[model samples]
Target: MGFRKGISILTISAAFALALSGCTSDKPAPSASTAPTASSSPSDSGEGGTDAKLEALGLDSNLKFKETRKITVEVYDRGNDGGTKPEDNFYTTYIKEGMLRDHNVEVTFVPVPRWTETEVINNYLAANQAPDVSLTYSYPTIQTYANMGGILDLAPILAENKELFPDMFEYLTETNIYWDQDPATGTLWALEGRLNVLNRINTFVRQDWLQKLNIEPPTNLQEFESMLRAFKDNASTLLGADADKMIPFSTSFDVGWRADHLTTSFMPNDLTDKDIYVNGFDDRLFLMPNYKEGIRTLNKWYNEGLVWKDFPLYPAGDTTEDNLMKLGHVGAFMHNWDYPYRNGDDSIHASLQRLVGPDAAYVAVESFPNDAGVYKKFLSGPIDRKVFFPATNKEPIASLLYVNWISKFENRVFLQFGEEGVTHEKLPDGSLKTIATTGEKIMNSPANIDYTITSNGINLGDPDLTVKSIANGYAGVDSKLIEIAHKITTNDGRIGKNANVGQIKAEDGQGQALKEKRDTILNKAVVAAVDKFDEIYDSGMKDYLNSGGQAIIDERKAAWEKTYGTETMLK
Candidate 1:
C-alpha cells in the first residue's frame, strides 16, 4: 500500500473515469533476433553527426549510445488486411529510420499473429527467441515469464536511466508505468500502455427495423427481450425474401466479448472490491455471481430461435458474423462503442447501406440495467497493452529510449496522422482529418497504432484537441452520432481496482489456457437446451474451476485479505 501506485487500491468505486481525448495480410515470416552488441560512445558516433544534430534539437545526445544499438520489437501481424506487410510497411520503415536518426538505434520488427498473440508470445519466450522488446495484451504472460526469470526487471534500468525516458514517463504517468509493480519486491517487469480513449462497449439496434415495426427502443432487460421477439415475429416483414436469414440477435464464438454488456448488467452493483478482484480472472465476468443467470437468459433466447443458432460453429477470424451484420440480417447486437463506423468506406455501416438500404443503420442504445437500476459498464482501466523487455534484451536502455522517442508528441503525431495532403490533412479549424491513401504511404493500421507502442488512441497533446480529432476521424459517419455513442460508452462506467498485491501465481502461466476453457463454457451454455442450461453451465464452470479458475480466485481473495483484512476497501 505504501509503494508508488497510480490510483489507490481502495476507494476505486463505480465512478465514470472519462478522458475524452480521444494488421494484415502478409503473414510475413518473423525476423530472427541476433546477439546483443555494445554501443559506441557519443564521441565515436559516425562522422554523419546525426546524434549531434539531434542533440542540437533539445535531445540529450549524452543519453544515446555513440554506436548503433539494434533492438527488435513485436508488432501484430493481421495478415496483410491493410494492403501492406505488417512487419515492413512505410510506417515500420519510418520508425526504423526515425529511431536511427534520432537515437542511433537500429530497430527491426518481429511479427506475431494478432489473434493468437498470447500463444505466439509464449512460444517465443519458451524458445528464448522473443524480440528484445515485447508487447502483449495479456499481463499474465509477462508475469509468467518473469516468474521464470525470462523477463528483465525494468525497475533498475528505469531508475538508473531516468533522463532517457522522459516522454514515456510523461505519457504513461505513474498509474500506467507502475501498474504491474510487484508489491512485495518493488520490482517491475512491464509498463502498461496508456489508453487515451476510455469508452467501453454498447448495445446497438437497427433504427430502421424499430421504425418499421413502430416499436420504441427498449430501456431494460424485459423490454429488450420483447424487442428481440418483435424482430423475430416480424422477420418476414423486415426481410421478406431473407426472413429465414434474419438473426434477431447475432454474436460469435466469443460470446463473452460480443455480449459483455448483457452479462455485466446482471452483476450486482453492490459487489465489494474484494469480490471484483477475486472473480475477475478473465476479461469477461462469466465467473461473477448471477452471471450464470445471464447465460441462462441467452440460452432461453437461443431455444426460442431469437439468438444466432450457428454462432458457436464459427471460430475466430471466420468473418461469418461480420458478414451477417453487414448484410443487415442482424437486428441487434452488442459490441465496441464505434463498431459500425470504423474502416471508412469498408466499414459495416457502409456495407449495410450498400447491401440493405441507405436508410438502414445500426444505432447505439441503452437497454440493460443492473440490480441497482443503473446501467453499469465495467470499462477497461487506463492501461491498454503491456510493454516489457525480454531477458535476452541486451539493449534495455536503447529499447526504453526507442519507446520514449515514440511517446514524444511530434514523433507520435506524424505516425498517427501522416504527411499532410496524403494520409491526413489539417482542417481550417486546426483539427486533423484522415483521408484514404494508396501506394507506399498508406497506413497499415488505423491511427498508426501498431507503431505507437507506448500510447493508444488519438492524443493530439490536448484534451479538447483529442476529443475533436477523434470525433472527426470517422469519415462518413455523422459527428453527432459519434459523440452520442462516445457518451453512451462512458455512461456509469466503473473501472476495476488494480490491487497492489504481488503476482497471483496461478495466473502466471494460465491466461491463455483458462481463456479457452472459459469460452467453451459460455459458448456451450448459450446453445444448450433450456432444461439443460443450468446443468451444462454448472458442470462447465466446475471444470473451469478445477482447471485453474479456482486457484486464481483463491490467490486473489487471499491476496486482498492479506493486504486489507475484513474491509470492503472502497472509497
Candidate 2:
C-alpha cells in the first residue's frame, strides 16, 4: 500500500493487474514479438537526438548522464507469487543485463498491482510518485489525468522527436492521432498503443449447432433470424437437455455491444449520410434514429425468445458469457473482441472441444448488414492503450529517450521476446519458438513488459508478416482459426467508423455517468415489451437528458462544431 515500493514484496492479484479495463485485444499475442532488424523505417532525429549514437541512450545533449541514472517505471509483476521481483523478471533483467550495462542506468520497475490498476495508478499519480511512464488500458483515465494536468503533454516531445519513433509516429499520423486529445489543449497528452488495427468484431455463430439443426449461416437479418429460430427449435437435440435454458443471443451489462453491431448499419459517420451523428466524447448516441431501431430489433428478438432472457442483468466483462458459453447453451455472440478462433490453444476452438467434443465448430460468418444494407461496426483503431508520462517524473529527458530507445529495433525485441535462446528460440524460418506454453510466460515472461513497455504493435513494419507470425504463435490450435480473422479483415469487411473526431471536456466526469445511464436505459428498453419500449425509453431518455445528457450533448455539439465545420457537425 505504501508508495515507496522499492523492491517491496507486495501480494497482488493476477499478472493482469496493470491491464487496461477500457479497450481489450486478443489476450496479448502468443509470444509474437518485434524484430530488431530495421526492415521498417528507422528514425535518426528527435527523441534525445537525431544521431544514431544518441539513439543508444536516447539522451539529448541537454541530458547529462551520470554514473547511473535510476529511471523508475510502473512494471507489471503478474504477482504469481513465484518469488520473481519486478526488477529481476526476465524482461527487467534484459534491461539491466543487456541494455543498461554500458549506459550505467538503473531501471527500477515499481510493481503495479494488476487487479486495481486504476486505483493504484491514480494513487501514484496523486502522490507524485507515479512511474516515469505507465501503460494503461483505460483511455478515460488517461484523458482525466491529462485534463487534470497530472501528466505531461506528449505533443511537444512527439513533434520535436518525430524521427525517434518513425514507425510508431507514421502509424499515429496515418491513424488520425489515436484519439488521445487533451481536454485543455485539444491535443494529444499521452502516447497511444494500438491493440488492433484491422479486423472488425466477427459475428460468431454456433456452426455445430447450425449443422445439427441443418440451418445455413445467416447472411443478412432475415437469415440471421432464421438461424436463431432454428437454434430455438432444435435446442434439445443440438444443445442437449439444456435446450430450454439455451440463450440464442446475449450481451453484457456494462458494455452491451451485441446490439451495437445492428446499430452500425443505421449509424452514419458524416454529413453525407442520412443518419445524424454528434461525433464527440464517445459519440453521444442519444438522438440517433438507427440506435432506436437497433434496440427495437433486439426487442423483437427478445419477445420471440431469440435473445437471452437475462441479458439486461448479465454483468459485464465476460462474467455471464464465460459461464454461459461453457454450458454450450449460447448459440451466437456478435461483439466477441478476439474471436476465439484467432486465439491460440485456449480459444473458442479448444473451449468447444471441452464442452461438446473436438468436433464442435463455430461458424465464422460475415457480419450481417442492417436493413439499410450496411454492416455497422465500432471503431477500435487509432489506439487502445494510453502510454502516459507523469509530471513528477524527474528524468523527463531520460524517460523520453528511453521511449525512443525502446522503439529502436534491438531494444524493442528485448522488451518483447526477451533473449532469443533463454526465453524463446529462434526458428530456422526466422520466427520465434516460445518455450513457455502459457500465454503469460511465452513472450515477456516473469514481467508484464509487452503490456507495460510500449504502445507499438507486434510487427513493426510489415503487417502481412505480422499476421503470419500471429497465426504461427497459435500453432497449438488450428492455424485456420486465426487466419479467418485476417481473411475477414481483407474481405467484405463491414467496418463502420463512429466519428472518433474530438473530445468534449464535459464528457469526462459526468459524461461517463450519463453514457452508462443511457446504456442501462437502452438495455432495459431493448428487453422491454413491444408496447412498453417507447414508454420506458422515452421516460428514461427524458431523465437522462435532463440530468446530464443534454449538457453533454450541448458541450459536445459546440466542440464538434468548433472542430469540424458547422455543416459537418449539423448534417
Candidate 3:
C-alpha cells in the first residue's frame, strides 16, 4: 500500500487526478518489474544455489530459498470434520512433510474459519498479514487488492514458469480456458484452482422422503412446489416431530439462496441463455431484469414457509444444510450433487441413514424444467475459485514452489489418496480401492482447496486420477445415485456464451464499492413484497449508478464491443 511499485508522489498525484477526471487507459498501467524470462521446462535452467535449484526446476525467479524457511499460508477450517483441523490437518501435514520440508521450506497453515472467510481475509489483508497464497471467488476483491498493490503481480512469474505448470497453463490458456487478468494491464496476475468434475451443480433430493410421502420426484415448477408442500405436510412423521425443524426447500440467504440452478427458471440475465454470475468484475446486477424475479421467488417461498425461516439472519458461509440437513430436517436441497455422502460418519447421508436405516436413499432430480421448460443454468468451466499471492508475502518463491509441488501429479496423488498402502491400496487395474479410514471419501482431503491450490486442478491430466475421485464417492454399494448425478451434471449443465473472452477494464476497480452499495439495497428487495420488488430495485440501481455503477457498466460495454463488436453483443 505504501507504493512498492516505486512511482514518486508527483506521478501518483497526476494518476489520481486523471482517475478523478474519469479518464481510463485502454491498457493496464505499467508495474515496477519488467517481464520475466521464460523456461521451456525444468531441465532447461542452470543449477547451484536455492535460486538456481528453483530455476533448474522451472519455477518463478522470485522464488529463492536460503536454508530452512517457514512460510505461512491460510486454509479454510470449515469445522465440518475434526480430522480437517488446520494446524495438524492431514493435508497441511502432507504439504509440510511430503513437499515443502524436503526443500527446507516449512509451511504453517494459518486457519481461517470457513464461515467468515471473506471478512477474515479482508481483515488480514488490511493488516498485511494475509497468507502468501490466498483465494476468493469474488473478482471484485481481487481487483481491489491489485489496485491497492496488496497482491503480488504473478503474470511474469506464471508466464516464465509455464513449463512447471503445463496443465494449469493449458487449462487457463486453452480454447475454453478461464483465468483472471490485471484490470489495468490485462496481464495474468492470479491463478485459479479448478473443480475436477462439472457434476457439482445439480439438485439433490431425499428419495426416502418422497417414498414416505408417496410422491414422485418433481419434474416442473408446479410439481416442485407441490413436492415442497408434501415435504412440509409429512415432515413430522418422516423427519421427527420438531415443528420448527422441518424445512422443505432448505437454503441460506447468504449463499445458497441464489444458487444458479435453483433460480434457473428466473433467467437472471438476458445477456445469455444462462445466468451471468456477476464475476464481481461487472457489478451489473440490478440492471438484469429477471434477477429480481429470482429474488421474488425466494421471497414468495420465504413468506409461504417453504424456505428456512431464519435464513436471512444466517452468516455468509452457513448454507441451508448447515442449518437443517445434517440434523435430518431438510426434505430437499439444491447443492453439490454429492452432499449426502460427504463428511464420513458425520456426513449428511450418515445422519439421515441413522434415522431411517442402512438403506437410506437419495436421488438426483436430473434436470428441472424452467418456466419455459429448459434446463440451462450457469456452470463455470473447470475452475470457479481463484488464488493469488499478496505483496506482503515473506517468500514468493517458496509459495510458487509449494504450488508447483501440489500441481505435480505424484504429490497430488499422495494428498488425494494418502500414503498409498497405508491409506489406500493401489489396484492392479489402475483404479483406486480406498482404504477404510484414510482415503479421500473417508478421511483425506485435497490440500488448500480454499486457496485454489489442489490435487483437483491437476487431476485432469490422468485418466486414473480423473476416475478416482468419483470412484471414491461412487465406490458405495449403490452407484445409481452417483451415476444419475453425474449424468444430470454433464448432460444439462450450462456455460456462459463468452465466458473466457471478457476483459477486466480499469473502471472495474469501482466494482467493490458499487457492490457494497448494491448489497444494502439488495437486502431490502429480497425481503420486500413481490409487487415492491421493482421499487426496491430502482432505488438500489439509482444509488449504484450515482456512486459509479454507470462508469463501470459503460467501460464494460465498451470493452465488450471492442472484443466481440456490437454486431454480436447487444446493449
Model 2 lDDT tens row, 292-372 = 776777788889988877766654333456557756778887754345553334455666677788767665576566455
Task: Find the candidate with the highest lDDT and give its number.
Answer: 1
- Model 3 misses residue 187 by how many Å? 3.4
Give candidate 1 regions above 4 Å deviation: 1-62, 80-82
Give the runs in model 2 whose Cα sits over 4 Å from its true position: 1-64, 71-89, 92-99, 102-105, 108-129, 136-143, 155-188, 268-277, 283-287, 312-320, 411-436, 443-453, 489-503, 563-571
Better of 1 and 3 by TM-score: 1
Quote the lDDT for 380 in model 2.
51
Q: Show the colliding residue pairs in model 2.
A: 15-78, 17-114, 17-115, 18-114, 20-137, 44-50, 45-50
lDDT of all the models against the reference? 0.78, 0.56, 0.57
Best by TM-score: 1
TM-score of each: 0.88, 0.73, 0.77
Candidate 1 lDDT by residue in tens digits, 218-314: 9999989999999999999999999999899988888998888888888899887778888887888878888887888889999999999899898
Worst 10 residues of 2 by lDDT: 6-15
Model 2 root-mean-square deviation: 10.2
For candidate 3, what is the lDDT?
0.57
Output the better candidate (2/3) by lDDT.
3
lDDT of 3 by residue, 1-571 (tens): 1101222233323333332332232334333233222323323323254344443333334333445656777777766544546556555666788544445678887887766676677778778788877776566666677667677655544433345444445444422122455333645546766566665566777787888778887777678878888878776777675856788876654432234465555653344422242222432334554655666676677667887666557655555555367666777767665666655565667666676676566677843565556775555556655677776765554576677666666666555566666556666656665554633333424323543354343253676655654555433425667667767765645643433344445444564565556556656666777778788878777887777766665666566556555454323
| Ranking 1 against 2 by TM-score, winner | 1
